[model samples]
Target: MPATPSTILVVEDDDIVRMLIVDVLQELGFSVLEADGSARAIELLEDTNQRIDLLMTDVGLPGMDGRALAQKARELRQSLPILFASGYADTVEVEEGMAIIGKPFSIDQLRDKVKSMLGI
Candidate 1:
């Protein structure tokens, strides 16, 4: 194992879902940060001391949705990899160095997606 595990920031509005995702990532041996919305996510993102290897977020947030949050996150940390979890709505468009995972993903799928995004 590497000296330090990669860290991921996960943003989702649902508390249960967020816990489930964080649990899986922890089982996979990654350090994770959780935020229920963009406001908290921005706080974590803006803290330069935090080491975030990837961002995985739900696209449909209450305010300051995931896409906008991602834009802001990019402004704070250039080249940070981002993954969006959407229900596959037609409106969600992924940009370069970013990816999207459909909602209700299996644990294996989530694991694969995160690892693929992190290039592990």
Candidate 2:
């Protein structure tokens, strides 16, 4: 049997960027959940019973930030992979089991990075 498509929770404050990311991930055949900020992302993480394969978040969130969100998310799901997207690459540190995708990424770049992270 074919493997199930992985579900990714995307946390980004920018509405247009978040929508674009959701569309891209969906087009690439991955399930996606979206949040406008860290609080909502954490709320979703705490509330959902569904399996979330990855957490993709922006580094510069309005509150709590992506690193903190990732930490909390790991507490909720220990093995969940994280992908950090940022415009300020110099300031963001990449953690273990985490990948970084720079902002202004093309569809192919995002698709490839996500696929590699998920090992699909």
Candidate 3:
């Protein structure tokens, strides 16, 4: 039997990048929820009906960067898995058990990283 699609929250300020990631997630059989910034992402989380299984956010954003957003999201959803993607290696540091995917990643890399994070 096939596995169920995981619900993912993608926080990205760039429209192109956000769309690309959303498309990729959809193609990989995951239900994607998008937000342009930290505020919107937080709002989505606060919605009573929504439940995000994972968070994939870009480290560099306009206002609240991925770190701050992840921190806030963690407060709300303590056990949610996070995958921080960044162009710069030093920009997004992985926490105790979290992981980081460097930007310009290929489809395979993204899939592998996500599967590993999700333990699929």
**In what order do the candidates fall by lDDT, top score first?**
1, 2, 3
How does model 1 fare in lDDT? 0.93
**Candidate 3 per-residue C-alpha lDDT over 1-120 given as tens digits, one digit per residue, 9 for 90 to 100:** 136688889999999999998999899898899999999999998886897888989888788989988898888888889889899966655886478988899989988988888878
Q: Model 1, stretches more than 4 Å misplaced?
A: 89-91
* Residue 19 shift from truth in candidate 3, angstroms: 0.7
Worst 10 residues of 2 by lDDT: 1-10
Model 1 TM-score, 2 decimals:
0.95
Model 2 has an lDDT value of 0.89
- State every prediction's TM-score relative to the real structure: 0.95, 0.93, 0.92
Residue 50 shift from truth in candidate 3, angstroms: 0.9
lDDT of 2 by residue, 5-111 (tens): 88889999999999999999988888899999999898888976876888999988987999999999989888889999999766777778998899889999999
Winning model by TM-score: 1
lDDT of 2 at 71: 93
Look at candidate 1 and tell me the lDDT of residue 83: 93
- Report clashes for each candidate as comma-separated counts: 0, 0, 0
lDDT of each: 0.93, 0.89, 0.87
* lDDT by residue (tens digit), candidate 1, 14-73: 999999999999999999999999999999999999999999999999989999999999
